[model samples]
Target: MVAPGLRRYPVTMRLLILIALLNLPIDVAAAEDRRVFFGTWGTAKQCAREPIKPGGTFLAEPYEIGDEWLRQGQLWCLLSWGPIEKRPDGYFSGAHARCGEDTVRQYFLGMVLSDGELTLRWGFPASSGPLRQCPRS
Candidate 1:
């Protein structure tokens, strides 16, 4: 009792809908796994009292802990105290402390620019510098 064209339309729409539903989770998972700041960064400018130097580099590794994407890395020659939280403005802020022969603690703030350059600052002794992204090997 149904028209020949109408029967194919319903089946076609259902197939399209099913395909979209199947891909939704995969698309979401891919987005969550991809991180914008996951790489090594280096600078040619030196900051007083900072560990990274004109030729030195640091690594940024992004991981999901709970419901947040945290970027963890070493700065000023010490491991970060905790994961740095990314802000709405694309900047990350956290605290780090180093212990050994000389103990040091600092609050860290950094941002990745549109050109892929990184700018960082460490409180106390006041160090700030610009870093460029390094090529992956």
Candidate 2:
């Protein structure tokens, strides 16, 4: 039985429509937001101040990534980091190189934001929790 004013789509057309709907992408902006790992991240006390001290002894871990480099200390050239790459597992990995000292080769696993808290997963299963982004001065 067909409605008076409604026309039925062919089975092939209906299948195409279903396929198109299934292949349609979710929110692209939201997906991109999840992948953002820029800016400085630290603990409560660390991020409490407007400008985080560059070389604070109290901070056990300092994580900062800029446009081209990842820094551990306040000084830019002190610690070296290679180009970071996003892995297939949705984690960023980079080589922490300390050139000209002992030629040490360290690595940064990745970082992710969950519920506004940024977590840095780097080395030996150690992850920083409840780290917030510091306000840029």
Candidate 3:
């Protein structure tokens, strides 16, 4: 009841399944490693002063790990869905799209230093200071 050329189909499928299973852990580990921005980030200084106050605190949650981006939210508002890239100087830079604003789609850049300081700049005013990482609940 089996074709001559199709006899190896089951074995081939099994081998493919096994290979995919073996790669699962590596994929998961990579995702875990990309979760560097997950958690609450806070700063006493204002990060924006143009359209609205950037607030004293912001949280970065895992959104699309495959895209290497986080869902950045401020107090009671979603700020940006942006990508955070690591620099060679141990600093992380992120360009985020400000949410709930004009159709102009202004992009803001934020840099987090090794000492937990964050520098954010957009259009007019900019903010920079030490940012404290909030304890996760």
Candidate 4:
């Protein structure tokens, strides 16, 4: 028979290792959660220079605003080059968002795409706000 002290040792170690292995992807993604936001045309210029999924966009509508943040605000639509990194949790991160001139009035934007939806957060020296995406087509 195995010694009492050693009986569960190997099994416990194996289980711990297994757990860590299972969590490996999440650990790596957590490390990549790091991100940055840009404002004005500056961030857009930089993102536009980088490689991404060409013709990306951020579209928002007034009535679609969730009840929690409800208002008859202006509808906004922004465009970008493409998809950024998609995390293990299915959240998408990307750089370089340019707002629609007439609708959004031209600002730098950052986006999180998931949940069959897109959420945009704009940044500027003076202000920022969360805007939901209304997909095209």
- For each candidate in turn, the TM-score is 0.35, 0.45, 0.39, 0.28
Report the C-alpha displacement of residue 116, candidate 2, in angstroms: 1.6
Candidate 3 C-alpha lDDT tens digits along 12-73: 99999999999898767644544554454554321221223345334333121123332344
Model 1 misplaced regions, further than 4 Å: 1-38, 44-76, 81-89, 99-115
Model 2: residues >4 Å from true position, as ranges?
1-35, 49-62, 74-101
Instruction: Please give, for residues 1-137, the per-residue lDDT of candidate 2 as tens digits.
Output: 88654554576688899887865553343334333666787775665542446675455445675544556555342333333444454434343433233454555545555555666666648866667777765
What's model 2's overall lDDT? Answer: 0.54
Clashes in candidate 2: how many?
A: 0
The positional error of residue 26 in candidate 2, measured at the CA in angstroms, is: 18
Model 4 agreement with the true structure over 15-89: per-residue lDDT tens digits: 999999998987565444422222222123222333334565432223232211222234434444233466654
Candidate 2: minimum summed lDDT over ten consecutive residues — where?
A: 75-84
Better by lDDT, candidate 4 or 2: 2
- Model 4: how far residue 42 lies from native, Å: 28
Q: Lowest-lDDT window of 10 residues in candidate 4?
A: 34-43
* Pairs with backbone N, CA or C atoms under 3 Å apart (clashes), candidate 1: none
Better of 1 and 4 by lDDT: 1
Question: Alpha carbon lDDT of residue 55, candidate 1?
Answer: 50
Which numbered prediction scores highest in TM-score against the true structure? 2
The better candidate by TM-score, 2 or 4, is 2
What TM-score does structure 2 among the candidates reach? 0.45
Q: Which 10 residues in a row give candidate 3 its minimum summed lDDT?
A: 44-53
